[model samples]
Target chain A: MNIISFLNILLPFGYAVAVYAYGKAFFADTPWAKSSKRWILLSVIGTHIVYLAARTTAFSHPPATTVYEVLTLLAFTTSAAYYVIESRTGNRETGYFILNIPFFFQLVSSLFIKDLLEVPEILRSNYFGFHVTAALAGYSAITLSAVYGFLYLMLYHEIKQTRFGAVYRKLPSLENLERMSVMAIWLAFFFLAAAMLAGVVWLPQAFSDFSYADPKLIGTVFIWLLYGAALAARRSTRWKGRKMMIVAISGFVISIFSLTAVNMLLSGFHRFN
Target chain B: MNLLCLSISHHTAPVEVRERLWLSPEEIVKTLPETLRLGCSEAVLFSTCNRTELYAVTDGRLPHESLIRELIKQKNAGSVVHESHFSVYRGPEAAGHLFRVASGIESMVLGDVQILMQVKEGYQLAVNAGTAGFFLHHLFPSAFHTGKRSRTETTIGTGAVSVGYAAVELAERIFENLRKKTALVIGAGETAKLTAKHLRGKNIGSLTITNRTQNRADQLARVLECSTIPFDRFRESLADADIVIASVRVDTHILTADDVARALEHRHTGALFLVDIGVPRNIDPAAGKLENVFLYDIDTLTAMVDENVHKRRAQIPAVERIVADELHSLELWHASLQSTPTIQALTAMMETIRKGEVEKNINRFGEKDRELVELVTKRIVNKILHTPIAYMRNGHDAGPTERLLSVNVIRRIFGLDHDNAKRDDDA
Candidate 1:
């Protein structure tokens, strides 16, 4: 197999190994878990970069050209975001909970992922690349927010019920979890806002078929407004705590619906061939 | 292989019997010199409430009985301690036992990390008495290294082992950092005081103690250096506290569902950890149903503590692996003691011969050529010695007798004298 194909086959296993290592570190307290888990994750991200680069060079199109390639990019960006947050916060206890997302994304993408050496002229535009990168970054941040929100809710219930299990002992404090969730939401909002702006300015000039009322565009903008309002409400002291986490998690679900529903069920220019 | 251990531990003896052999650090220092006189070249005495073990490397005799008798005599418990109370380990097994002890695998509490420091102090005491050397110097440090490896490499020391600690552990799980959270302890009883003390030890932001008996509450607050709230008005301050510990002796629930709901609404905080360690139930069971209120009674806390203890027990094999790994390395080094002197002599004699031959030939060459010749000859010698040195350092897991025979065979083949081996070491 070519390097791109080889990495495509190898990518999911890399994440799976990272997932196992993080699990062992958090749950079983294995020796190699803590010292090497972060490096394992970083190596996977590095390998993924090589895979994306190889695919772009071989197929002569950026990774943003196909749904499968976009999934891999999403996986890459999500893990990279988690790594940055972990390094900055020095809170690695929640890595096990957070890593499952990228693992699932990469696993599915690797299975059905294709190599595209050539694409339509519009797909080659730098504007489309920036737009897709921004959108992927935003989606990755939302994934992180959802994971942290889910951990917060788990820890929240564990405490409320006085169940001092692994979730209770290994997770960060509720305040910290809530803070991280909000931070991810804020990041998602900014990236998505930029993606939408790029789309609005570049779409009409690039695609005669593009419409303002297209389902994917409208759904994405709608998801953006949903989080934007959540952040604004929290800023104004109207929403916080368990309720805010629920909203962030709900936002991820709706975004997933938009990604799948608008791309699969609805007819839209976002379903580029 | 000369190493030996005479141990009287809780596993082999009753507490009454074990305590008789206990020695203060000073007493251990005093007794260490006597151990060298017991046919041992080096000695270390480790004495605690759970165990009293004398580890020594004898020059010729085992003297396990004599060491036991001396320890019993030192404690004036000759009538109490019997031969059955002592477990003896010899050679690598002796090193392995000490490794287990240092790593807390042999501790009464499974992974008692405090035993590591105690073992460290025992080594220091032996050093102070000037009875620790060579084997012990390596052995004790290896034990310390084993202890460190076991702690860092396993989950043996991670969980809470007691109910009071478990309560605090639950709180820690909720609030990532307890330094900024306030604690409100209801009642000035011992349970309340202990839980309060644990909270204070963790450096909680503030503490407010309340009790029906105002005088008792004031006394406890003064002792703990915290403020006191009136028993009735304590409910008003509940919203300010992130952790509420209820150990008050009361007939009914001190905190009902309504009280918790109002607190959660008023606090504007994320969560509240309420630990009820009272004899009779103090906090309402219904309060645990509240969204942000976490209520843990004594039984639940005990259950969590039990689970943590089980987790620690499950880590025994992991710690044992560390002990085994360290013991193997120590045994290799100990085995080297047998063959190192011979290898050193061979290298020294070869160097002497090389220097002699170089001096004889130096007049035939210029300065640059002579230096080059010396370098080439040295490299040649090292290449020739590589196999022998590697074998002597670590070729296999050689027993003492095997190692002795190997070293003797090497010495005979190299024409190396035992005394000639000491020159380089002494230098």
Candidate 2:
């Protein structure tokens, strides 16, 4: 009915159109279709920014209280990250695969738009805001790394099998995909470390009885260690190509589990409404 | 007016015959004017390693066979190719052939891109020599447009089909990005140098050249601005390289299965692509079975090239459709030119009759009335001629015989042929 509500309905539809356009461009290999996909994506991001700005203004805090709100925020961060990587690499062929994540999250967010809730006092700190934003960005980067890893393995198998089908012609070179995955992993490691630092600093102030037994805290530490090991292996060991790709992909799966299972199914101080 | 093309390509003539008929730049310069003198109003001579084509336009004054024979005789006094060996096409077929040639459909190597540049050069030479007239000036641009459309719209020019290019393409497939990958050339022979040049063009991270003769390797390295490693120490560099090109002239295998297995163990990561372009196969065929080692001998590379060539060949039907579309448009233009002389004579006759009648009626009226009468008579003549002029210009798409019959009837009724002949003589 209002601007925020209208944008809530429009954002998912916009993503749907962009996804369709990107898929068409990927298959048809038309420059015009690709350009249209880019413009549509930019406009969707614009609308998302407006919606988030309005929600924050109305609530007197960032939209980090509810599941739908976090989903919406994740959608925005993931799309932004994809835009940056796609621009840097000049590789748009992976858009259809990568954009699907944000599309699904945005759709879910829109479906639960009526469930917007007020933030609790402890969750409204600047430290909490920084932690949530950084964590989302890290998760988005890890997701991208996983996507590239999957593409690399697929192309590698296709080449090894000598199928030489659409995948062989359309996918980026295996080396390029590997490089992109490594770059994404590095970005993910940096942001995840920042989020952990922010969370550790905020713990003493926000909780009267902060403990190491919290599921969210334990999951976050586990993911950090796993990715750290992956990065260390990449730098030190001769574990590259398929081994490195598998590491990145598994790291993404663990991050997703921590984000969903540890936050909802398990009791933690980081739980949302 | 008529357009004609006389061509002898690798398909129609043997190499000896093509060599005899080939035209050098100096020969084209010397013989182009002679070709024009033989009643060719315009001409473009295109000569490449695989083909030599002469596309010409004439005013229907000289026979096409005589013009072709005289030109061939000038190039080779004792011509081995009979006139029949030179395929001839007239009218729209001639335009279609030029389009096909420009678009690389007629290339010995399917979708070879070099011929497009050669076509542009030939057209430029014809223009500079003052042999290109209205028809050729229009034809060349349309042909170029068709060539560009076919390439962009189809997958005819997508992959690498030559041996040197195939090596580079395979490297890209293995590593995805060559900018961060190193390449090692095994010998200082022509194939090795060519493969190194192709790799360099891809902006590889580094290039190392090694040969049995250190002096030759250094010479080549200096030219390529790359480093030269000792021939014996080349195996040390192999562990660091992403691509190894073995083109040495040794009868024995330069790289054995055990050697590559050792290198693979040392280089624990990434795939090592070995291209054995040498005849006796420098890399052992068994080495290809080793883990993370990809060895492609000459036969394997040739098979890849053949596969790519077949892919390009599959695109010929699409290119031919483009050629046919262009030819149709060109035919409409050419047909428009056919009715020009008749239209000009008809307009000239009408103007003369209007002026003569105006002079005879001048004395029957006062000065003001005579001026008004002249204007009215001029308008009447133009009004009467408008339908016929419009019909002539717009009727170009009609059947040729029917259009010719209509033109003949108009000329008979208006007596335009005599006027046109007389006007030509006066001019």
Candidate 3:
């Protein structure tokens, strides 16, 4: 029996089980449910490691070519980001749902994208790899921020209706959610700035276009500007609580569309290859 | 139940009542026995500056007023009991109230921690007294677990909210090296003590404690490894102090802007951190506006606490889900207890009947030995209970007849009565 084939299938199956276990520990009323959640998280991380390793062996490159590779990478980075944040705060379970969202996107991408697509010669440069990797990491981090933003919105909505306000009691407090979102955004902003800079540095020599006038590039810059404004507002203690969350979410939404829909429709460097 | 929550809390009563009801360690030991003898099955008394609650679980199921009256009478006979400042809850309501209290839901600041551990300690005291029985044991543990789950699942306890913590955070934000700074804490009140403790934890050196009650100041100094100054010499010590936390409730200002300016003249240009936790503003507000002097009042800390409360309030759903899940698990176990005995008794009766029938059949084999007889009996019993046990184990025994017969059918069909066997399962 070939070990590589077995692991490729097993890892995704493990991810599914991990996701199910997460749901169980989060929702089910049992004695050792917490322990179960810890185990599930460990399993996901473990399986993801194996999955990445196998894909590396098969493709002979860092996993970021097709939609499947991008989705998996995105999910892994998102989950990893949340894991660090949650561990720091001792909120191991609140981030579980946020972490699993990428898995859904990955599963869909895996089903559609054919395996072993040939890499374009133009995309073979080291700058291409660096730019793509950084951008994906930035997007993943922003995705986590968006998750927190959604949680804040949900909490805000619930508090408005007195009867449904009980669930708000279960989440991290509004300030904590805001902080989590801001942290994610700021971290992503750093990576995004680096990625944009790398792309700019690569453009004149690699693509002969010095200006980042491409729709995807412009959209990313807009996101960067929006987040920079948010950071400045946060420092001044003005655009913090709810307003900050809404802006962060809107910026992330634009980034998402720019990277996916806009990239597909209009010509851009990063697209669903 | 005898649940008297005689509390001089931030709610129901003021700080004056709390101070009056506050019992020292010696007073607690003296009052415990009397409190217990007054029909209180268990008593856990908490006397903090924010609240002083006497949570007692008792065997009496009378009205809340009667319970309170009884508790007051019992406690009054031994020590002075302030009946006007008491609140009472009974049974489930009392349990739920305590749970909420421990969970920080009923806190004046809404999600201010420090109550849960106090509640745990109170429960432990009751346990140590051998007064905690079924209800108190289950209830207290549940309360503690709920509190743990709430903090773990949410960000209810985040941010530097308390005045002491805010002071530390601000200090760290400024100089970052508290080890070199001299922190002088004024007053021997709870706030001052807490602030000193926070400062001490940060490795601040050269602590100078000065209180109106010099002995109290001396005691605090000894405990915190700080130097105690006479209250009259406080102004003299302020010249070299890097950080001053004024926590006394003085009618008039202790450190005016002029005194602060003079102190600034004497002190280095590094920084002067002043935290005024006193309600009447121990340090002049204008003192903070001075060059190289940062001042914060009790309101600044209160605002931080409010903001944290807002954050924790948002985490309510996550905490609630955890509590609700645990409660459901408890209910499932409770339901399992209701049906388990019936299932066991029914299975046992079937085995007994099977053995009897096997013996009767073995009589036909008069020449057979005891080995054959035992083997045949085992086979027959297994055959009889196999289907029903399987169904019950698989959670498929759905019919009313099965439910009724599981308890009664085995008895009627096999002539198994209470005299044959007695149930050993109490739960």
> For each candidate, what's the DockQ?
0.38, 0.59, 0.03
Q: Mind sharing the TM-score for model 2?
A: 0.89
Count clashes in each candidate, considering only residues at least 3 apart in sequence or on different chains: 2, 0, 15
lDDT of each: 0.85, 0.84, 0.69
Write model 2 residue lDDT over B1-427, tens digit each, in one string: 3888889899898988888888887777677788888888889887888888888988766787887787678777464867777888887778888999988988888887888999998888888888888989999999999889889888888788878888898778778678888889999998788889989989989999999999999999998999989999998777888899999888899888888888877785588888999988898889877645667788767877888888998999999998888877776666566678889878888998988988887898987798799889989999999998888888856765566677778888897887678788999
* Candidate 3: segments with Cα more than 4 A from true spot: A1-4, A21-31, A122-125, A160-166, A203-211, A268-270, B1-427
| Tens-digit lDDT string for candidate 1 (B272-294) | 88889987899889988776677
- Sort by DockQ, top down from the best: 2, 1, 3
TM-score of candidate 1 relative to the true fold? 0.76
Clashing pairs in 1: A59-A117, A173-B176
Model 1 per-residue lDDT tens digits across residues A1-273: 677778988999999999999999988878689899999999999998898788777876678876777888898989988887788677887888888888888988999977665689888888988899899999999989999999999988877766667787778888788888888898899999999999999999998998999888888888899998898877765377788999989989999998887778888677745
- How would the candidate models be sorted by lDDT, starting from the highest? 1, 2, 3
By TM-score, rank the candidates, best first. 2, 1, 3
For model 3, residues A157-204, the per-residue Cα lDDT tens digits are 543232223344356655567778888898789889999999888867
Best by DockQ: 2
DockQ score for model 3:
0.03
